[model samples]
Target: MATLQDYRNERLRKLAALRELGVDPYPAHAERTHTCAEVVEKFDELIGQTVSVAGRIVSIRSFGKLAFIKLRDASGDVQLYLQKDDVAGLDASRGVLGMKQLKLLDTGDFVQATGEMVVTKTGEKSVGVHELRLLTKSLRPMPEKLDNKEERFRRRYVDMNVNPEVRQRFIRRSKFWQATRDYLNQHGFTEVNVPVLEHTTGGADANPFVTHMDALDDQQFYLRISHELPLKRLIGAGFEKVYDLGPRFRNENYSDEHLPEHIAMEWYAAYWDWRQGMRFMENMYKDVLQKTFGTLHFRLGEFEVDMSGKWDVWDYAEVIAQHYGIDVYHTTIDEVAAKLKEHSLEVEKTDSIPRGIDKLWKNIRKSVAGPVWLVNTPKFISPLSKANPDNPQSVERFQPIIAGSELGNGFSELNDPIDQLNRFVEQQRMRDAGDDEAMMLDIDYVEMLEYGMPPACGWGWSERVFWIFEGVTAREGVPFPQLRHEIDEVTKAIYSEAELQ
Candidate 1:
């Protein structure tokens, strides 16, 4: 393998060549009046015009006796036809450019170019080179352009230069988020930020990541798994409509479907019901699909999901009855447990069979495809939801499931203080009984409910939306993904006994 020393050797040679030409290979700065993109955009207006432009060299077509090069900046790419007879900078760094020279210029190298735009005989966009300046030298080699690979597209900053489709996806990703914010604003939802750190807490199930602070002799909290608990307090304080679209941290399993820290869009509207939440979720995504991709059909793995179609609503208990021929309200817990065992599912004797049924639904969710409102969930599984008025058995909650996994959890938020406290106490018992995923009894959240917060439906969904709508796995969407056993250099330094102690 070519090593970093080999890179230093080649770059030193370039430095020597530039020194011989009396030019600094690494200059402090370059002044330019136009970007490669702006020149091309205003081409008709700047025809025969001398424009000062700056960009990194992207493509070079050399005619040994002469050369043609393309330079790119964030705005766009511009081509340069450098005829050796008129060129000023070729003598020092001379060669048939290797994909490796792309290494020398670096696929990611920053550069500046001064040129005039002109169309070649083939009527292709091209620039006549007058001058070139190096910004930052790139030493790393990029994937071969003609390889037409899939992974390079996932490392999409590199692919954006070579693949038009990859570039367009990112462009759409940008617009997709912008459109969501615009929609939220139009609906009178005020954006609010919640503290990631907590002392005494309330939120969804799952263990929190523990962090310590020596100076205060306190264990400083790391961050939250979800934004639900804090946002609810804002609801209690009378913010009628609120939303938070940001990153949430969870210490959990790693899979194509999960990331430890991920983006989520949580929204709460006062005086709303589970039905209202359903309408908003269904309509919000359909509009986002239209605004982003201009269509509702998204290729989810091998299957196609139509977002614009009717969202089939399924009751949790009814679906369980339909799927397993067992109902918790009508059947004994032991019978539910027995049916699950008949289906080859197992659970600790301490766990209720409804918990086993919950597991089955998650497994079956993978086979399901589309926008589905999975409602009327079991009370044992959803601690934050209100028990149904009619059934009193299942909670009034549902998740928007798409492509098998839940897009998010939503419900008619439980605001009755007595019932909420009882649920919290039950949760504490579950935690004491060795279920670490059980939530702690958050007395404050219950206290706030006693103050009479309005009956509002709140939904918290982490942005597995990118995974669902964009047709990629959850881990595939995050930029810097967490690796299970990888020890990064910077982290190692911080974790060293001398530093940590």
Candidate 2:
């Protein structure tokens, strides 16, 4: 049995042999006339015509005087046919490889083949090679299959090659974000990029990751937890409608639906309240979903959710009262904690009435298979949302419950500077009371409110929406997810001479 090192050494010997033969194993450039997919898809028109295709060699088979190579590019894969008598000779300057030199190539090596589109004796569409050039020489062969979870994440490049479906998933992920931007732009929302770093980060109830900036006298800064504050500042700066989509950081643990670092989008419409935001979001969801997934119906985990029809609205306090038999408005901290323990939810000593009640709400949320709107949230839990005109105890905030999770949050943004300050102060008190996930008091944002921001509705959501609909966990959904730092024993042994720490 050969170890990885043994296989690697064998490839190294082949690499040396190629160099000795005056062939550049890793060429700087290779010309290609069409992708593998095009050659196959346009076979009727391309038949008997010379075409150049470039891709990584997926497989190589030889039968005495004849050889066949399967090449794969981003679009798809195609077969390359070679005849011993007809193939071109090796040309190091042009990076061309003769039929005899095919023995030096491996499955993972990238090559460019210029050939005439033809059908094989077996009637398989393929390119008959006239010339083959080395684009890249792989020292470590890509695994034929990647099934281990940790190894898949650690070497996603290999995983992508071995499992093309993983690559396709990311393609859909890209489409998801693009559709989001398209819908927003089509509806007159100008995208304005905001800063990722903030002097005082206070957008959500999540602790922020802090870093030092040497240029600013080594002052500490927090990575923005949400695009909320700065985007709203743009609203105060007189933008009628604005939005931003980017990565935000939070110092938190990873979960099936949460990542400390994730891509999120937030939008604000100056004259609109939560109701308008809700309707707009529903339409936008339909548009984006249709574009990305080609359908509005999704079987996410245990729930069947449809974004097409009318979404039902559920009052926040009412839902909690029905489920837990406790009024969100009048519930005591002790009562909330008792319910928390009853449901086996986490009950901390620092748990505020708002926090405990939220946990209870989430407990019920898990059972809600909805494109349902949850509205009229308690004022204490919703610091930045406006107090409802009809109910002072509840703010005009809304969240869309889908597939057992809150997919998004929207609010009738609070613009009263005095009211905003009081809420900030209360949140600051929570922070002081050892609830680190509490929002920080950003005085600058309060000042922006003092300067008179118009009545607006704001909405935000993360890539978790994509994860839920795509039916993948947080780590699996992301292209690369953070893992605990570790240098495997084999890696350490391999790099021992480099004196790596």
Candidate 3:
């Protein structure tokens, strides 16, 4: 059996042979009149007419004088027929150059073929090659298949090449964000870019990855954990409706659902209350789902959710009472902690009363199977949200829950500087008491709030939406997820020798 090194060496010899025969193994330029998919889609009109197509040779079969090749481009794949007689007619100087090139080409090599469309005896549509040129020569052999999850993620380029469905998933991811931007733009929202580095990070309960800025007198900075605070500053600056779709970092434990860095979107609309926001978001969700996935119904895990159907509403306190027999508004920190421990659920030591309550709610949330709105959350858990006029104990917050997970969050903006400052102080106390995930005291943001911003509603959601819809983990959805560095064989051997000594 040929090892990877052996395959590379053989390709190197072929590369040298191609050079000797006046063929560029890696050409600088090539012309292609149509992609593989285009030719196949217009096969009827293109029949008997010669057209140029370029793609990587995904499969090859040779029958002495005749050969068949499977050529695949980004658009799609098509079949190619290579005959020795037709190849000899195209090249006057080297009669057998086409045959020799066919012998030298590997599965991964990219080639351009000028051919007329033809139907084989089995009525298989194919391109009958009269001219062939090598565009890119592959030195290393691509794996027949990549099955291991870690390996697939590590070598995503190979995985995408070998698996068309994997390629389509990322294409759909692009469409997802595009659809979101289009929907927002149509609704009079202007998209803006926000800073990634911040002196203090707030807007979400997540520890941020910190870095030192040498350009700023070696001052420490934190990666923005959410786009909320900065985008709100724009609102304070008189932007009626603003949104940002960008990357955020959170220094947290990795899970099937979470990543350290991911793309997130946050949008705020002035003069819109949480009620109006909920209605707008429902339409936005339906639009984005229809545009990206082309379907409103999805089987997410064991639950089936239909975005086209009317969304049910569930109060946060009611959900907790139904599942854990505890009232979120009346439960104490100690009681919540004891109940979590009693149920053998993991609890963070630094968890404040609100965080403890949230943990209890999450346990119940996992079984919801809802295309529902979880509304009227306790004030303690929603520090940045405006309090309900009727019930000051609860905030006017709404979270869309689908298939047992919170898909997105929205709330009425807390515009009062004094109220915002008080909430910040309480969060600071939590941070001081050892909760690393507590929101930072962003004094500048409070100062902006003092300048008077309009009454508005804001909503935020991450690319985890794509993960849920695609039925894959967070890592699988991302093109290149973070992974631990693997030690080379030489380094491993050195470490082993050191251990023995």
Candidate 4:
């Protein structure tokens, strides 16, 4: 069995041989008149006409005087036919390789083929090559199969090549975000990119990743845990309809639905309440989902979700009371903790009444297969939401429950500085009492609130939405997930002379 290093060494020797022959093995340019897919799709019209195609060589077969190469580009793959008598000789200046030089090419090498469309005797659509040019020479061949989770993530580029479905998943991921932007833009929302680093991060109950800014007197700054505060700050700055789509960092452990860092989008519409926001999101969800997946219905895990129909509205307080027998408005910390323990949930010493009740709610949420809006959450649990006028204990907050998880959150923006300050102070007290996930008090944001932002409704959701609908884990959904740095023994041995550890 030849090891990877042995195969690499063999390629290296071939690279040297090509160099010695004055052939440019790694050329800077190649010509492509059509994609592999186009060659096949337009075959009837393109028949007998010379066309240039470039792609990675996926396969090669030779029978004495004749050979075939399967070239694969992003669009698709096509076959190239070659005959020793008809092909041109090597041209070092143009980087063209004759039929005799095909022995130097490998399966993973990139090449351009200029040929006339034809059908083989066996009736396979292919290109009859007159000229072949080397574009790139791959030293390390891609693995035939990449199924190990650890290796797949570590070498994602190789995983994408070996498993094309992984590549297609990311294409859909791009579509998901593009659909979001399309819907938001169609609704007249102006996208403004906000700062990724903040002096005080306070949007959510998640510990933030900290960093030092040498340009700003070496002050300690935080990687933003949410885009909510800064985007809302734009609302205070007189932006009527605003949104941002970018990465946010959260210093936390991973879960199936959560990553320490992920892309999220938040939008705010001035003068809109939670109810209006709810309606807007329903349409946006339908539009985005239909555009990305081409359907409004999804089978996510064991639950079936249909975004086309009217979504049910569930009162947060009522759901908690009915499921766990605890009034969210009047629940005691001890009572919440006891219920948490009875339900086999996490009961931490730092768990406040709000946190404990939330855990109990999530337990019930696990069974709900819904496109449901969970509204009227307690004011204490929603620090940035406006308090409901009808019920002061509850805030005008709304969350979309889908496939047993909260996919999105929205709130009637709280613009009252005094109320926001009090909530911040309360959250600070929780932090002092050993709750590391409590929101930090951002006085600057409070000052902006004092300056008076308009009545608005704000909503945000992470790429977890795409992950959920796409039926992939947090790590799998991302092209490259963060992993602890490590050098394998094989890699270290390969680079031993370069002082690799």
Candidate 5:
């Protein structure tokens, strides 16, 4: 890390270098322009046109008397093949530019160039430089090579120079959101913005980020865990289709697949069932993938998942029973506990048999191969879902598992006021038993249900969907992840002395 003093000294050197050239380091602007894309798009036609552009100086190849300094600007990078004869307009004849022309130059320097686009005999489209300037200087070194893996993530600017694939992923990410907006618009799903600060948080298990509310003085507000509550209010107001795609907070552990904050694409459809939820998601996911990647088959890890295919389905209970050699539906609580113990599965069932069953099922779920619907969950486990008519003990819900992880969960929502109340009571009991992740009493939501919310199937999925689809961990999909940056040694030293006092 560069200290403030280091930056100041580097700036001084840069100022001195620019003064030696008799040019301003920070010019107001470059006069006329063309982007890297425009040059490439109209290459032969743009051959004699002098166009100005600016970007980080990533590479500079020097010949004896002439310098082939590669200047890259936005929309992409192109080499500025600078000849000794044509270096007059942008810089003076002496100082650091001349020294850099003479000695080795590092990577992080920003430069501007005015040149004509021309292709070399090597078939490389490069800028034939008529004028060149060092817009800024870099005291520290950049990636030795553009594609250097050691610097790929730490110094992303260098990675952008060499890795076309990184550019492709971000481009595709933009396209993915655009397709989502397009698809939802066509389907009558209206985009919405909801409040981020909440008095009471629900709708998901993850903990929330805490912050003080100035208006309320000592009152603390939480960053929302899920957009479920607010979106539901829109349904109450007669909007059948609503969606929210934005940042969500989760005060939780970090991993390659879990960020404290991430992007979530959540939507609700009124009067839709679990089956309908499954179908809508399948169609939406397939369409989004095709729109972005031009194919429905995305390879996750070592397995290729075909999104366009009929997604395989299996009973949720059956998934567990198959793994542990016991029919969970027919077995007693003691039997299930004994079996899990026998299998050496560490589960705290005595805390709550339902929690124990949940843990056991979660372990069982990981072994599932490919995309399969783990449906018909035990009702006690999923409080918000409607129980199946034939099997009152099980809920009409399905988890869409892809690459052995649940990408989405859906259920026929409990619209029956009595059933919902009973479930809420059950949840309250769990909370009382010290399960903070359990749902709390939402009297207002229950009142909304009492007002006759149509028997709707609700679906909810997290940002992990995009992470898996992109073949990157969830952490990489997000811009600023939760991993800790190292504390400075000076700060540590000061804190240590203060603690002694």
Candidate 6:
């Protein structure tokens, strides 16, 4: 039962041994002609040709005068065959420094190999090494396996090293956002970067993380909870089509689907309504999904959703009536709260009437396995959306629902300054009434609307799309997620009772 320090000490001895034998344990540079994947893919063309490859040594096997090392690079893995005779002719300066140098190399160390491609008798494609150079000497040994979720998240670098699938998932996540940007760029959308710090945060119902800026006369600022307000400001500035994709912060509860900080994308298009927005959004989803995952079908949780076919549309009021037996337009806040309590659903006492109804809808939404569009939202629940002309009580809002959650939100933008001001004022009242998640009254945004913004459509979605499609929690999809600091046993033992006093 050796401690980690003991293992480290042994590796340190090897480091010293390498230095004594005129081998640099850590070199500044190494030659690499091909990646592991390229070497494997072009094996037939490259056979008998000397090529250089570099990677971390994942595994090693020794048989008296020969050794087999499994090398892993970013692209893929390849086998390297080392023989006592091959190393004698590698370098004239370090003449015939044979098996001793190879024995010093360990797993987790990065090494570069110059070798000729050959197939083993057992049919494994490998490189026969004539030269080997240590690129980096790893001081700490990697864990045999990373099984604990918290540990894996805390040490994502190690987790990714041990788990190839985890690495692939992040690769796909990059492709997902890239595909989104490509689709928007093709549609003539100008990508604009908005300020992350704001005096008044609005555009979505969420508690904001606040900080004070010393440079700005000690004024308090909030991290932008949503990209809505600033992107719309661009629309008022006469940008017909604008979009932003970046990080946003919200001081709210953490769940399988939620994170305190996450990447969000929002876009606004002038002279377009919610119907046109929906059509564009559907196509965007299809294109991005195909580009990233290479298929329309995804297994998210227990549901298998297919985005290739036509998506179904459901009215918000009708959905609530059918699922919860409560008409969203007709039900009182108190009555809805009572119904939620009857079903043992949790409700916050400080929530506004609209928030209460929203919570009820969310509970019902869990049963909906859909690539469905939920439309005709009640005006109170969607203050930023334009009111439907035919039905003033409802707003022209649509949400893409998938696997029991709202995947994204879109609506016909409410550009009338007077109406927008009134809605902001109402929302402010809710904030004053103790609903911390209520949207703030952004007077600047209202003033921007006074300058006359064109009728537009807006939509937004977060990286939760990646999480849903990959069938992972929000924490898993993200490379590094926030976690509470844990006091290790050593730290606890270091702090004595006398120090506390």
Q: CA lDDT of each candidate?
A: 0.72, 0.92, 0.88, 0.92, 0.72, 0.89
Compose the digit string of candidate 4's lDDT tens values, residues 110-216: 99999899999999899999999889989998788889999999999999999999999999999999999999998899999999989999789998898999998
Alpha-carbon shift of residue 399 in model 5 (angstroms): 1.6
Candidate 3 residue lDDT tens string, 104-131: 8889998888889999877888999888
Clash number for candidate 2:
0
lDDT of 2 by residue, 102-185 (tens): 889999999999989999999999999999999989989788879999999988888898999999999999999999999999
Q: Which residue pairs of candidate 1 clash?
A: 264-463
Residue 79 shift from truth in candidate 3, angstroms: 1.7
**Candidate 4: residue 455 lDDT (0-100):** 98
Give the clash total for candidate 1. 1
Model 5: residue 428 alpha-carbon error in angstroms: 2.3
Better of 4 and 6 by TM-score: 4
After superposition, candidate 5 runs with Cα above 4 Å error? 1-12, 19-22, 28-32, 63-65, 90-106, 119-124, 145-167, 325-333, 349-351, 488-501
lDDT comparing candidate 5 with the true structure: 0.72
Q: Could you tell me how far off, in angstroms, the CA of residue 257 lies in candidate 2 after the best superposition?
A: 0.5
Q: Give lDDT tens digits, candidate 6, residues 155-205.
A: 899999988799999999999999999999999999999999999998998
Error of 5 at 431 (Å): 1.6
| Pairs that clash in candidate 5 | 272-457
* TM-score of every candidate relative to the true structure: 0.85, 0.99, 0.94, 0.99, 0.85, 0.94
